[model samples]
Target: MRIRKVIPGDARPARSAPGGEEAARDPQFVEAIARGFTILEAFTTRDSMLGNQEIAERSGLPRPTISRLTHTLTRLGYLEYLPRFAKYQLGIAAVALGQLALANMAVRGVARPLMEALSQRLGASVSLGRRDRLSMLYVEHAQPASAVALQLGLGSRLPLAVTAMGRAYYAVAQAEERAAIDQQIEERFPERWARVRDALHEAVDMHAALGFTISIGDWNREVHAAGAAIILPDGGIAAFNCGAPAFMLDRDRVLREAGPGVSEMARRVLSIASGKG
Candidate 1:
């Protein structure tokens, strides 16, 4: 099977203006820590075991820097080195940290039941996601009871430039943030940017007009999806999408039926999260 490629967006942490000014004045900011974390982040679910050169390519760090960071990370128990493959993978500490983060997120509990119900009703897969840097990170997923359903699961990350959930997120994002992300998309995906640009804008407009966004064979040629977003009481934005094979879920049906259902489900989830329902 040919695996689909998900182009990752720029995930470098933005420097805080105040902190940057302070660091410039104080000269105590540990740049090494940030670089080390960047090296660690280069390993993803798709690119789990990476050698120094691959790590350098993915993280945009120099080869020498990556070597040192990997060594340090391996020694610190944040990464494990595989001698046979000459690669490194995230260690137990990273798994523990991920588990801690997931345990603290209350939204999963609030949304899972509703997502399962919606998945069953529509015979599609329902997923809840949040913005993770420049990607939509799947936080929860529910699939229909049917034997055949999309297999996207929690921890799957999709590009912010093409996916329905990503477009819904862009629709709700602040204007300045959206502009920054758009510029990055244009720079990173110049070849495909022209094609995706129009579709992305259309999805945003559709979201504004219909309270949901639809994409048919845009992200993945075999899949069709619709998404809706809601702002939680804690001020974080979350999006839910329903997706299935394009042959099974036609565009018209998605726009007319699944779209509205997904949008209403998102609203109800938001209401419950905000203590209003």
Candidate 2:
């Protein structure tokens, strides 16, 4: 498989000074800008809303730093303010940027029509994502006729170890790349790594056998997910997944049906991505 060169803003290791040196490395708020993004990254698949104090505590940035960054982010339209509740949430501009990126991505166009068809057939939500360093970035997502559906917006980042989409992509990555991604995860999110590290071998075997991976509440409780990779022309992979609330999707039926459908759709999307379609 070919490794592509980095495009601007493609996720990479957050280069601060080696471990304890971060606070002492910069005189200006270069560290502050880094801290601001760190605070932003603290919001994730599990946690949505956070108070200033919560952000301060989570990011390890001072309370004043968190406050200034939150205020600036809110004013810049990247965050929303809830004055009464003293909480902050992602704002419209964040969603808009995500939508714009999805609109422009070549992989998204090739995967969209197929995802829609798959969603209709399975009556569940379908999602497409790519590995950005150790994270899975949502690139395309579709929902089926069921009353409730996962509403992950484009550009949302999910952990790559516990989630099916993450595992599928991880399985396709080259050994060195996989190790690097894993190392980054271990360093960045140690607690999460402890949970999924031992499961890697099993996940790899599952991908080799099924041509995809299935996750049940590994990332989100009561959420069931199945994922496969669209192999590009160069033998690289782009990841995609389908998710449904456990109550709506029978686990056995998904394993029997959705698994194959997602695998087949991924192959088709790969063909299209490679210009073979």
Candidate 3:
């Protein structure tokens, strides 16, 4: 897995940076670092282990370049090379960094206790998360002791296009960011987007009207959830989601109880984060 050290002033054979034309004009944009992240992102929950060739195909980078980057990442503990399968998975260092990032989020500390009380009172699961690409990555959650259907816990990613949490984030995102997100999602899911596009907009409009959104059996056929977004101290959007099994919470409860509950939770989170509470 180890490779020779990258020499000083090494020449880049293919400087294929992403972000299309915008990234091309940026003088300060570093391709080497960006390429490493692209490789890291090539592995998903379903494809947790990937060989160099698979990494290249997913990242749209050259195979040789993928090998070099994977070797470097393996050495740096950002990727773990599994000789048994001739593939690689994210390593402990990457996990540590993700955990550290979540730990440093002051809002998690402020939100989790409130989320716990809400979960208990509502008899559902409450989560706090932020957008990670086209997904919502849960940083913290509280589940009621009576048992829940969803197995999602910390670090679980919920798709942005379908889930309540994702809709809340999209609802709160600026216009430019929303357009970019829409383009990426459409590119990745062209066939599905044709069917989902109108509904997604409807949800966004609902959020605008009510300050929260609902997703009933969208992400999972048996789950019902609602999400509300709040602006964080860093000007980023994080959402609070409350949900239970579809049988436990019908459409009415999701709109009446879950939706407003998440909205209130978001306001409380914003108040504490902004030092107004």
Candidate 4:
């Protein structure tokens, strides 16, 4: 689904995405290139290294195909192969591309200082991210010097079905966009969505009323966060969240402190991005 704009109480109406040839529907779609990218993406935060068999299982491609793709990706500098472990992880080329993309994001430059200030004040980590197909990919972040702080940062992916950031983005998504995401959720994570459906709906409504949403022990049982979203000048929603481990922040403190902190930072970001600040 195309991105949509959402703001508290005053967002402009969303427009439908212009018609374009989608991958599944396009005759000119390159399956081999897509498969290669899929192989690279199979490496997640949990599994930084994976052999051909592991990549095949995660990517749903044949072992021979994975071997070919891995070899090509490694040769092209997108994946680094470890000889002793006989495994592959993302390589410098991939890191270069990701850094290039993040470096060019104007909003991130405007958000980082705000995030750092908030993180310092709350002793929590503040992150700015946008939706990356079925996950929220942190593009920038700030963390306090707390021992209990989550170590996730740039390139880290959070589950889109249950995390506070994902919920806030879903809360702000235009109706048609939300419907598209709901369909994807059912298709990609049916049982997980079923379990969180009611709570998600409630959180969306709370975002409507309070300009923030909470996720206490939903994504990570030890992590607690409050989330809010901002509509960029290009009409895309960027999700930002603040939180720490359960030992550092209880539910009541998250509601009273982190909720408002994240919401205020989101507003500040929107203001700057819109040239109003």
Q: What are the RMSD figures for all models against the true structure?
A: 5.2, 8.3, 9.1, 8.9
For model 1, the local distance difference test gives 0.80
Instruction: State the lDDT at 25 in candidate 1.
Output: 54
What digit string (tens of lDDT, one per residue) describes model 3 on residues 29-105? 77778888888766655568989877777777888888899999999999998999999999998989988898789
Best TM-score among the predictions, by candidate number: 4
Predicted candidate 1 versus true structure: per-residue lDDT over 12-73, tens digit per residue? 33222222433665688776776787777676666678899877777677788778889888
lDDT of 2 by residue, 139-242 (tens): 77887765566656555677788788888888777899888877777877788786677776677788889887888877777778788875677665788888
Identify the runs in model 4 with alpha carbons over 4 angstroms from their true place. 1-29
Residue 76, candidate 2: alpha-carbon lDDT: 89
What are the lDDT scores of the predictions, listed in order?
0.80, 0.75, 0.81, 0.81
Please list the residue runs of candidate 3 whose C-alpha ends up more than 4 Å from where it truly belongs after superposition. 1-32, 43-64, 84-86
Question: Which parts of model 2 have CA positions greater than 4 angstroms off?
Answer: 1-30, 42-51, 71-100, 132-134, 151-156, 188-195, 233-236
Q: Evaluate residue 127 in candidate 4 and report its C-alpha lDDT on the 0 to 100 scale.
A: 90
Task: Write candidate 4's Cα lDDT for 1-277 as tens digits.
Answer: 3221211111112111111223656778777887887787777665788899877777777778878889999999999999999999999999899888988789999998999999999989899889976678888889786555776777677866688898999899888887877776776567777776777788789999999999999877888899999778898999999978887889999999999999999999999989899
